[model samples]
Target chain A: MQYAERILDAIDMETFILARDEGEAKGFMGRFLADLGFTDHDIVFLEQVGPGVRVRARAYIHRPGGSYGWLAEGDDNGG
Target chain B: MVAEKKKILLVPLDPVHDMGLKLIRKALDDKGHSTVLLPPGMEPYEVVERILDEVEIDFVLVSRTLGYRVGELLARFVDLVEVSGLRDRVTLVVGGMAVRPELAAEMGFDAGFGPGTTPGEVVAFIEDRPFAYGGRAEASEGGKRDLTHGFSYVYRKKEIQKRLAAIAGDIMGWAANKTSPGVERARLRFQALNKGEKYREEFLEEYLDYCDELVVLSYKRKQLPDQTRFLAQDELHFLKQYQNWEGRSKAARSGIRKPDVFIQYGTGCPLMDIMHIKVCEAWGADGLVHFDPSGGARTEGLLEGYLAHGEDGTLLTWENLRLIKNFLAPNTLWQVRAHRGLNTPETVVLAGELGADLTKINMAYASLGAGMDPARITIDGVEAIRWAAHYDLPFDVVTNEELSGVPAHKAFAGMLIIAHLALQLGGRPILQPLFCRSPEVMIYGQMRDNYIDYNAAKILALQQIIDAPLWPGAPIGFLTHTEDRVQSSLTTALHASLARSLGVEAISIASSDEAYAGGPIAAASRVDTLRATHEAFRFFGRAGIQPTPRAREWSKELIAGISKVLKDVANSGSFVQSLYRGLLGGPEDGAYPGRVGRDTLLRKEKGKDV
Candidate 1:
């Protein structure tokens, strides 16, 4: 969980999901990322190839102009 | 200096994989180091015996692809050498797949090299000299290049030149006495910036008078636009701290270097843009283009803040640009684009004052495709281009109108007129022809056969028209991309390779998320294209991609079509009228002359708004 704080902006996960259609594949991926507790997420890429789908999805660990986990106030101590 | 000749040994531990060692031995032999390469499948004790029996072996180099039990196997060899009493005199080194120097040291070896280690690197290790890895020499010395350097701007097609000259003269005469809100804002901003503190407030008061009420409210009432917020203090503090790291990345330039690659970054937020810019620079982006919000273009003025919008492009603001400018790598070319915006003049002023390396300007494209008033943009664009020259900032005359369904020839005609006008104003202009599967191409089947010939034809035609630099995109492979990262990256890389093959000065490439309209572009998508382009350059290495004879035919056709469009515009007698009439691009072609800022021109002589 602490490692998540070091991410620069967002974390992307590229994977494959076996599903009937592109929509179903995307649905499965959304649930998969949600299960892992990523809310601000979107499927960057999804394609129904063969019986499965090739998917690349992302969850924003930190958005720009928001409080950054990477720049978490550290030993420098809340300047 | 030739390294001191020493006896070296090379041992390929694998039974049948000695090709790497053979190459290393040849390099070592050429370097005057006597290398005794032991055969593969040699037992550790046999190699130890050979080292012990050999006359004072100075080095025992072993090559083994780390596999199952390979680490333990190499450790036993080091132990055998130690027990034979030659370990003190002999240097033992291991190299092959998956071998890191740390792993080798842990395995009781002196050093190790992973895959992609060159034979020259191995020789340098044997010679005890430093080896520059990953072509760091080129990256460190890879200085910034002027995209418009060494172009004479001579027109090879004199007939087209005549038509262009007429168009340029027509535009200049029309723009001479005219001004717009954009122009006045730029002038006031320029005075406000250049003048002392005494006159700054006076100029800003006059500047706000020309801006939209929303803009004036932002400056005076400190009210921000919808979905726009200023960056928090701690975020900026972290950003300021982020500015400390040096640009130690240039892996993007792994090989051939004709066309410098640029990446456009506008993550709606300046902080995110900064992160993307740094990631792109590390990945070897030679330049960065600041993509501002489309809403900023329709609005009559630019805001002043570290504004962050939850949108597609970053908001154009002085504070946002200044922050981005400050953190740019020393050699990284920075471009602040105002090509299609209502704040064209002020954007140029900001880009110039902030030390941006480049800017983008194109009146015809702005008026027709991007929905800006023809007359207003001409006046504003003329002023912007003039200031771009004054700031010594070279700009690209982009033909993105082609993507709006305007055919390449018509869009190119518009581009040439604006480019010539800019050149006459003393600003350097690089012609940016969209290397895309445009609506025109899709409808006309100009690229149905291949993505080659037509794209190559654009370059070829431009080269024929003028001896100026061609930078082939705002992002090459625009519509050819799928959401698939592999497909998107390959198309971009292929287009880049094509641009490289044609010897262009620069190109803008898209992140693989170019087709993913679902959300904002991801950082990983940017990396995919960059890494792909790197491999593409390394793959071709001074070789060229040959387009079929159809390229020449298309080149001739494009040249003729551009000529016909220019002649038509010239005969129309008024360039602005031509845009209104859609001589450059019309309703049929999906390019509608915009009405924003219409009837808003100010005549200096008449002292009234038109």
Candidate 2:
């Protein structure tokens, strides 16, 4: 997964994510991560292998509220 | 052998400013020092305990902004560090405003950093690298000892000396760059303050009278076009809902006193924005004042875009205007923001000439951005007024300043005086002083210094101005919502309750849709509910009234302070200049990064070459 998707997943889903192009995504992702409210989430990196694609996701997850779940849907056509 | 990146602890003492901590963090981080930020307000003992228990920290940088308390806190913190036996292990560096470097060293701090320490000097101290410590290479040898032994005291002493040198360098840099836009603004502020005997005699009396007039005038302006998309975002849905309600007309609305304040949800969110309007209307608002600095960019666009959300969204164009006109009273003028670069004075003049009831041109920061000399703002204001007049366009001039980091007294004085000038020049003035508070106040619900005072003083001053007709503009209420804070509804209810006691003639409540999403139909329904509650209360009687002696005292003191500040700044030359000086190193003037210019002010330290 691109870095931007990982950072956006850290915050409440209500917050909208805007991306102008593919290239601006990573830098914007870092900034977006820095702006989230103080959440005591440990950084977790998850890697999922699909039919042909490998994706890495950097996530901040806490189980205090049982808001635990994985956003791992393997893609059939992986690049 | 590679040396480990040393851990550093940064502690920002209470009663001190936060900028220095942020600046030092950036500088040290760049110089390969792994720094940990201790939250503000931790006691010195707790801090010492944490340092002892945690990783081995090489240096402790403590910041104290307030003057006398710095010595006391530094002494206590140093004592704790010594008692903890880590005194030998950790270097101590004290930095902040009003810190006497020599005195700090005497108090047992190995080094002292006063204001203006550069990042490069800090880097040299941290790395134990051979570089110019102060400004000269000669002082470098005298300032250093072997970093291996007595590492705590030796490291700290060298860091302090380097920091003092950095301060001098920073001041010299500022002196050289005094003519830059940021510094010129400061110099101009000081100049406006020292407006000599001659200028004062010529202008002070007229200025005071103008101020007095602003105090008495009742400002009125055009409401947003009735049928604008912001208002029509949920009009069809609202109409449908109202039609279904028993005995209500298809046109009978629930929340908005008029369609103008009830309808549009600018791009940010609808709850606060729209809720603000409903509250204002509930208070029998005289007119609506819309502040879309970016001209309702995304929020309004969402409604106009009609991306399968509301199928019958076409009325958002001109038809919404017609609907709003049908719903509201004739006193409304939909004041549109017009600046030179983004908006043409002529287009707005055409708007007024084409029968726009009011056009608002804001000339505080935008005036500066457009390269308008401070003196030229008056010229811009005059030109806008002249065009409006020539075209028989009735319009208002507004200063939409957020006034972050400014003291309340300065903001109120400036807004009142500027509004008075607009009124004198034949244009109605709209003053949105809340536009100038700290983001914390706006976003986090923390009270900016003098927020209540400014609010009260503004209301009283505007009341006097409207009554006297000395200036053309009157005080119009802004429908501010604070949903992010706790008990926001209760807060709004309390605000309305207090506003009633303050005797404001008009007020605004945003529709429910404000500050959440665009003014969708669901949001409008929420506002309608609030409007009904307000109307129901009005229909019955005053919401129970009782004021404690303390509450009354606070109210009086706040208003009085606001009055004094206004009087003082007006006595000086430009209100704009005074306001700028109030936020000399703050973010509003674009001096630094992050909120209130804390981060920008801190990068004065330099990183050493690795």
Best by TM-score: 1
lDDT of 1 by residue, B427-546 (tens): 899999999999988888888889998999999999998999999997998899999999999999999999999999999999999989999997667777987988888888788999
Report how far residue B222 has shifted in candidate 2, in Å.
30
Interface CA RMSD of each prediction in angstroms: 15.1, 26.1
Number of the top DockQ candidate: 2
Error of 1 at B49 (Å): 4.8
The candidates' DockQ values read: 0.03, 0.04
Instruction: Evaluate chain B of model 1: give its TM-score.
Output: 0.91
Q: Go through the candidates in order and give each one's C-alpha lDDT.
A: 0.85, 0.40
Cα deviation at B475, candidate 1, in Å, is 1.2
| TM match of model 2 to true structure | 0.36
Tell me how many clashing residue pairs each candidate has. 0, 73
For model 1 chain B, where is the 10-residue window of minimal lDDT? B245-254
